[model samples]
Target: MEGGVMKEEGNRLAKEQRLRKAVYNAIITLSECIVETTTLQRTLNNLDQSSWMEVVEERYLGRMCGFPLCTNPVQVKNAQKYRIDLKNKKVFERSAEIDKFCCRSCFLRSAAVRAQLEAEPLWIRGDEQVKIFDLNAENVRQQQQDTYDVEFVEDQQLITSLEILKIGDTAESDDEDNDDETNMDEEKKDDAHKEFYNLCQSYLTMKSAVASIDEIANDPTVKRITDETVTKMEIEAERKDNKRLSESEKLARIRSKYSQNKFKRPPEIIEAKPFNSELCDKVPENLYQDFKRILSEWCGPETICHLQLHRRMNLSDSENKTVTEAKSIIAQFYAGDRSINKIVEDVFLPPVDNVDQAKQRISVLVELLKPSWRLLERTLNRNGCGQQALEIISTFRLSATNVILEKKMCDLAVAVIFRLLAYCDRSLMDFYPSDHIVSSKFMKYLEQIRCDAKCYFGILSIITNKLE
Candidate 1:
């Protein structure tokens, strides 16, 4: 971020330098034109350092197109002569222009006599004057950086260093007064405690605090520490604070502070994970699948699927209602969510312009599968009809493949193969300890064909022959 800021600042400085050079040359030429140098100089002089940017920016910084209507800048070493059509009065020059004239010939419109401009160049010596203008532009920038300006007044009343030292030193020594068996005289400690307690109660009510302060100010029991009493060895303590309070008043202040400390004590510290530069990408398999895994770990029993959206108009009431309900689902599927499959389908088979097929062809064999699937499963379990069932299944697959029907027709073909296998109580995804068939490779073949579910469904059906 610092490098980016420095680069931006450097670019700005370079641009400013370029603009300053142009403006200087323009100013020198202007001073020569009228035989006077003070008008712009006066404008520069009147401008405050913080406000001169507007004057610098308002000055034209580059050579512009000579064609009257166009204010576009000219970058070429030699600008082309301006050409215009007589009838329409449109200037012609090329700098990424897009117009009706650019696309085609304009021979129909008559050409006009070209306008010419002539000006003699004059050299001048005005560096001292223009240098000041450049410096003022820089000054405008520097003036913006001075953000802090308010000077705070220092409090200089007598808060001597020994008082601050006393506040710290009392931490250990003051605890002795709270105990009954302390060596300090019992009456003296009780008297000090009573004075501190009364001071606290008066301060809390604050009604007679001023009067009490006046009466207690002259109390001889208050041991005063004067400038001479605070020895040279304790002079370092003076630097902490300049206030010098009497011993009795300091004890009251310490009791008051300790009473308040209980309410403002900070909360317990919590352990935080340390910053780590090395990041581990746990799933190198797939990004989309990894995203689902991460969210699954975070949410656990509460399952969620990603639903990305793009720029769109307001959804209809029906769509919004359905989407919200689907988003709230807690149960997840192993394969993928419905939306992921839909997106994959769209990518692999983008909808053609006019080829959004309305319906699939209903072959007679395809029609028969709806009812015959169960009946075929029953008969194929017996001996003779096994090859017959296989032939019928193959015929259905070939017909559908040749016709190029939609995905559902292909799925119906796979259903036939699974039904016979199920009738015999064989299955995939389950392990029956005594059963021979626990899983099938047919599902894998179907996936390899991207779930088109090929119509070759009858190859794996079991046949049992009874010996007579």
Candidate 2:
């Protein structure tokens, strides 16, 4: 019976020891888990920097009804004004086991509250330039670079091993596939895998390149150097400005010193000569008088009357006196004893005796008229009575003695006639070769008559048509 009791006691002792060990292990594990949880929670809460706060239960001597947290001096002051006992000191200092770990939810709540209180709204001030945060393509590119760098550091060895394994697998697979069809299938799969691998490598290479770029972009030393360079450049620019001003002043002084005297020398005095050595000597005295007499006689009053007739008589107001008087003047010059009425009847009046004869005569005149119509055109253009002058010139056929100005009148007449013929009456083309009227003979005569007065449109038309 004693032996059975001893065996039972030994078994009970072994069971108790096992149970105690299990409880101790569970306690240690729980404590360690709590510590790890607190650490993780603190990190997530962004409270790696935190101060310890002790919680205490105090008994107030006065009537403080509820537990109100006295956060600030104002709260305490208010509580004191309400006659409430606000105790910040510990009342009972007794040792008690208490949990000292970060409450995951409480830590997050505190962090959020702190963040809310600390965060400032993005705002533009009236007097201050706001810092512009550009979170555009450059920011995203930088973020991508950071992510790639981390991924590469974490998986570089793994990727290299994976490649080795893939190559071995491919070799084995190739060896196992002996049939042509199976070999082709394996080759296609290998090619697909190679393409995938190459794509991955390309992505990694691109990512690595981007990361290196970011490293350069974010390098503080490079930024400092750039800022220093800009500062020096600004200083140098100011120096250059000052130097330029100094140089300008120096140049101004130099110019002032040299400009005291006039740079230009006085021109040499030159005596005026009476006449040139090559100038022609005087002409004979009688020759000058003869020339004057010829001019006076040729352009005298009778010539003026004849030229007026060429310019046409506006005898609607003169009882035909202008035509009659012009004929009388010419007769007076031509014949010593000729009656004005006879001279008029012979020269001024048309050869036709009646209206029927006049119409026939007009027909004959139109048929016999040369392009010397330019005479009236010139006389009319000069004297401002073009239509009447043209009628007179077209109608009258003066004698050679009376036609002293015939050449000028005829040349002017023919030029204007060509101008009219070139463009005016297309119907008259049957009667005259309009093309022949613009001939060199006609244009040369116009040049000799009109002098510097250019026939621009007429000349252009002639040149263009001839070239064509």
TM-score of 2: 0.15
For residue 3, model 1's alpha carbon misses the true position, in angstroms, by 88
Q: Tens digits of per-residue lDDT for model 1 on 1-468?
A: 999999998987776665456555444433232323345443343223222322222222334322112334434335455667788989986543112121112111101101010111111221223223322323443544564456776433212333433444555666655553455477865675576566556556776545576566566554254334557547758634436766786778778766554566799999998866333312133433332232222221111122111101112333333334444343223323444234334423334565422122224434544343443334333333333334223222132224442233333343433433333222321422322332244344344333332222222221111100
For candidate 2, give the lDDT of residue 255. 89
> Clash totals for all models, in order?
7, 3
Best-matching candidate per lDDT: 2
Candidate 1 segments whose C-alpha is farther than 4 A from its true place: 1-328, 333-344, 347-355, 358-368, 377-416, 419-468
Give per-residue CA lDDT, model 2, range 1-468, as digits (tens): 999999998987776665445434323332221234333232222211111111111101122211112111111222222233358543443332111112233333333323322132111111212222221334544655786784334567546646755767767766777664353556756776787678678766876676777698689998999899999999999777667677778678668767577778889999987886334322233432342233333232333344333323232343334356667566556645333234234445445455443335434434333434544334334223233333333333344343333333334333433343323223223323454343344444445444322433433333234323
Q: After superposition, how far is residue 458 of candidate 1 from its true place, in Å?
A: 11
- Candidate no. 1 TM-score: 0.15
Predictions in order: lDDT: 0.36, 0.40
Q: Lowest-scoring 10 consecutive residues by lDDT in candidate 1?
A: 109-118
